[model samples]
Target: MSRWLPWAVGLVAAVLALGPALGPGYVLRYDMVFVPDLSLPTVLRGADGFPRAIPSDAVVAALSWVLPGDAVQSAALAAVFVVGAAGAARLMPSPAAAVVAGAAYVWNPFVAERLLLGQWAMLLGYAGLPWVVGAARGPLAGVVRSLIPAAVGGFSSVVLTALTAGPVALWGRGGLRRGGLLAGALVVVSLPWLVPALTAGAAGATTDPAGVEAFAPRADTPLGTAGSLFLLGGVWNAHAVPAGYGDPVAVALRLALCLAAVAGWAWWLYRDRPGFGPGLTAAAVLGFGVALLGATEPGRGVLAWLIGLWPGFGPLRDGQLYVAPLALVQALGLGAAALWLSRPAGGTADGPGDGGAGAAGRGAGEPGSSAEPGPAGPGGRRAHGVGRIAGVAAAAGLAVLPVVALPGLLWGAQGALAPAEYPRDWLAAQAAVAADDRPGAVLVLPWSAYRGIDWSGGPAVVLDPATRLFDRRTVWNDDLVVGTPDGGTVVVRGEDGLAREAAAVLGPDPRTGLPESLDAAGLAALGVRYVAVSAPVDNRFWSDVDGFSVVVEGPEMTLLEVLAGPINTEEADISGLEVTCGLVTVGAIIWSVARSGSSLGFQRTGVERRPGARKEIP
Candidate 1:
C-alpha cells in the first residue's frame, strides 16, 4: 500500500494539473511541438546549429512508430508528474511525509511555469532528480540506471543532474573515485548531442551574448526577483506564468510555505543527519547563488563575459533552470516537516533516533529504516487525547498547503494547456512532402522559427510544426526574438550558417517574415526543392512565381515544388560519428543495467550501514 500510494498521488496530480491536455491531440506551446509520424531520419539529420532535439526527438520518432504521436506525447507529459512524485515521495523518511514531499515536488511554480512553456523534456529530467540524489552514494551502475530520464532529456537535463547530484557523489565515501564514475556516466549518456556540438566547428560552438539579458531570470511575483526565486517562480518569460498566479494573496501564502519548508529542512538536517543532506544543501545553495547571478547587472555582465569566452557557458543564460535543485530541497524539507508534525510529542518516529549514529548510516528511501508515522514511541507507548489528533491534522494540513498556495496550476493551468488537433491541410501538406522521394531540403516560409497557430481555438505560440512535419530536412529561421518588459525587443542571432545563407538569398521581410518575391534560381542553388508556407498568408506570393509548381495549397499551408533547374541534390543522412556515439551510449546504458541486475524502480535491500557517520550541514 505504501509503495503504491506515491504512484496514486502522482496520477491524481497529473490528471488535475493537465485536465484537457491529457486528452487527444498535441498540446502545442512555446518549445513543445509534436507532429504525426515524426520522421526519425529528419530528426537525426537535425539542423545546422546545436543538435538540441537530437536524442529526444529521435526517441520520440522511434516511439511514434509503435504508438500514435499524440499518445506518446500524453504518456511523456504524464510521466513527468508520475515519476517526479514517486521519486520525491520515496526520498522521505515516512509514508505521510513522502506524500507531502511528492505533491510539493511536482505542484510547485517551477514545474507549472516550465510545463506552460512546453519544455517537457527538461521536466522529464527534473522528475528524475530525486532518484539521482538517492543513487549518488551507491554503485556506478545504480547512478547510470537512475540517469535514464536525463539521458532521454538530452543536454540541459544532463547538466541539471550534474549540478544537483554531482556534489552528493563527491561528498560520499571514496569521494574522488565515485565522482569520477558519475562524470564518466554523464559523458557516456551525453555522446549523442555532445559529439555533434564539439565537432560543429566555430559556428555551432559560439552563441550570441545577447541571450544573457534576454533569458535571465525575471520576477514573476509582487515579492520581487529574489523573493520570487525563493518561491521557485522566477522564470524569464512572462507568458509562461500561470493565469492569475500573481495574485497578492497567493504570493503571501506561497512565501510562507517556502519559509516553513526551509525551516523544516534545517530541522531534519540537525536531527536525522541524512547521508545526502550536506551535499544536497551545498547543491541548493550553489544553485541558488548561480540563479542570482543573472538577476543583477554585474552578474549579468559576468555571465555575458563567460558566454563570450566560450559558448559552453550558454546554458547559464537561463539561470532560472538552476533553481530546480532548490525546488527538490524544499520538497524534501516539506516532507521532513510532515514527519515532525505527525510524530508524537517528545518522541521520535519509528525509524531513526534524534542525533543518533544509526540515522546517518541509512540511505534515502530505505523503507522501514528511516522514519514512519504513529502515535507510539520506540518503547511502544501510544499518545492519548488531543496531542495525537493535533499532530495528524497538522501534518495533513501541511500536505495540502502546496496545492492551496498555487491554485493557478490547477485544471490545465486555467485551460492554457488544452490540446488541439492539426488541420487537414497541414496533414495533407505533410503527406504530400513525405510521399515524394525528395533529394533536396524543404524551405519553411514566413522565414521564422515560431508561429501563433489558430487551430487550437485560441492563438497558441509554438515553434513551427512544419519544421519537423516532413520526412526530410526543413530549413527555417532559427534566430530568437524576445520581448522585453519595457516594450523593447531583442533579436538574438541564430547559429545555423545554412539558415543565414538562405536568409541572405531569400531576403525575408523583418516584420512579416515573408519574402517580397520568389527567387527560384537562388533557392535551387541552395538545394531547396520545396517551399512550405506554414502560416495563413494574406498575399499568395507563390501564385505568379515563374520557376515553381504548387504541390498543396490551402488557407493554412502552401507547399510549392521548384521546377526543373540545376538543383543541388545532396542527400542528407545521419553522420557516421553521430551514429557511432549513439550506439556507444545505448550500449553503455545496457551494460550498466545488466551489471546492476535490478531496475531503477526497485530498491536494493541490506545496504551496508556505516555507524557513526556524520555529514556537515551546509
Candidate 2:
C-alpha cells in the first residue's frame, strides 16, 4: 500500500487538475499545438531557426502513427503530473510525507503557470527532475534512463536538468567521473537538436536582445517579484497565472507555507545529513540567484550582455524557468515538514534528537524505512495517542495546504485549459496540402507567429497550427510580440532569414498580419508553392492576381497555389549528419541499458556505500 500510494496520489492530482482537458481533442494554448496525423518527415526536416521542436515533435509524429493525436496529447499532459508526483513522493520516507511532497511538487504555482502557458514539454522534464536526483549516484545507464523525459522535452529541459542535477552528480560518490558521465549522457540525448543548432550558422541561432526585457520574470502576487518567486509564481506572462490565484488571502497563506517548508528543509538537512542535501542546497541557491537576476536592472544588463555575447544564453532571459530547482527544494522541504509533524512524540526515540533515527532514517541514507510506532508505558501511551492524533491531523492539513492555497489549479485551471476540436476547414486545408506532392514550402500568412483562435469556443492564443499542419516545410512569421504591463508591445526579431525576406517582400501591416496586395512572383521566387492564410481574413487581395490559384478557401483557412514562372521547388531534407547523430544516440542508450542490466525504475532506491563507510554530507 505504501509503495503504491504515491502513484495513486499522482493519478488523482492529474485527474483533478486536468479535468475536461483530458477528455478529447487538443488543448491549444500559447505554444501548445497538436495536429492529427503529424508528418514525421516534415518534423525531422524542421524550420530555419533552432530546432526547438525537433525530437519532441518528431516523437509526437511517430506516436501519432500508432495512436490518435488527441490521446497522445492527453497521455503526455497526464504524465507531467503523474510522473512528477510519483518521483517527488518517493523522496519522502513515510507515506504521509510522500503524499505531501507529491502533491506540493505537482500543485505548485510553477507547474500551474507553465501548464497554463502550454509548455507541456518543459513540464515533462520538470516531472523527471526528482528521478534525476535519485539516480545521480547510480550507474551511467541509470542516469540515461532517468533522462528520457528530458530528452523528449528538448533543449530547455536538458538545460534545466543540467542546472538542477549537475551539482548532485559532480559532488556525489564518484565525483568527476559521475559528472563526466552526466555530461556525456546529456550530449548524447541532445544530438537531435544540438547537431542542427551547431551547424545552423550564426544566423539560425541568433536571438533578439529585446527579448531579455520582454521575457523577464514579473511579480504575479501582492508580494513583490522576489517574494512571488520565492513562493514559485513569478512567470513572465501575466495571462499564465491561475484564476483567483492573486487574492491577498491566498498569497499570505502560500507565503506562510513557503516559509514553513524552507524551515523544514533546514531542519531535515541538519538532522539527516543526506548525501544529496549539500548538492541540492547548492543547486537551489544557484537557481534562486539566477531567477532573481532578471528582477534588477544590473542583473538584466548582465543577462542582456550574455545574450549579446552568445545566442545560446537566450534561455537565461526567462529567469522564472530557473526557479524550477527551487520548486523541487520546496516540495522536499514540505515533505520533511510532514515527516516531522507526524513523528511519535513524548520521547527522544522518534523525536528531533534521535540521531537521525526518525524521518531521516527513511531518507536517502535508508530508502525503504518502514518503522511504525510501537507501544510504550501506559502514561507514555496516553501521551503518544494524543500526540499521534494531533500529528495526523496536522500532517493531513499540510498535505491539503497546497490545494487550498492555490485553488485555481483545480478543475482544468478553472476551465482555462479546456480542449477544442479542429474545425473541418482546417482539416480540409491540411488534407488538400498533404495530397499534393508540392515541392515548395507552405507560406503561412497573417505574417504573425501566434493566433487567437475561437475554434476552442473561447479565444485561445496559440502558435499557428499551419506551421506544422502540412507534410512539407513551412515558412511563417517567427517574430515574438510581447505585451508589456505598461500597455506597450515589444517586437523581438525572428531568426529565420527566409521569413525575414518574406516579410520584406510582403510589407505586412504591423497590426494585421495581412499585406496590401499579394506578390505571387516574389513568393514563387522564394520557393513558396502554397500560401496558407491560417486566420480569418478578407479575400479581396486574392482576386485578379495572376499566377495565384485558390486551392481551398474557407472562413478559417485559405490555401493558395502559386504558379508564377518557375518556382524554386527545392525542399529541405533531414541531413545525413542529423540522421547519424540520432542513430548514435539511440545506439548509445541501448548499449548503456544492456551494459547496466537494469534501468532507472528497476534500480534500487538508494546507492549502497561500502561497509563501514562514513557518510559525508558535502
lDDT tens readout by residue for model 2, 326-372: 89889989988987887766432132222222234453214443333
Candidate 1 residue-wise lDDT, 429-475, digit = tens:
88988788858889998888877888864567898888888998788
Q: Which segments of model 2 are wrong by more than 4 Å?
A: 201-204, 348-386, 592-618
Instruction: List TM-score per model, in order.
Output: 0.93, 0.93
**lDDT of all predictions:** 0.83, 0.83
Off by over 4 Å in 1: 200-203, 352-390, 604-618
lDDT of model 2 at residue 269? 72
Prediction 2 TM-score vs. true: 0.93
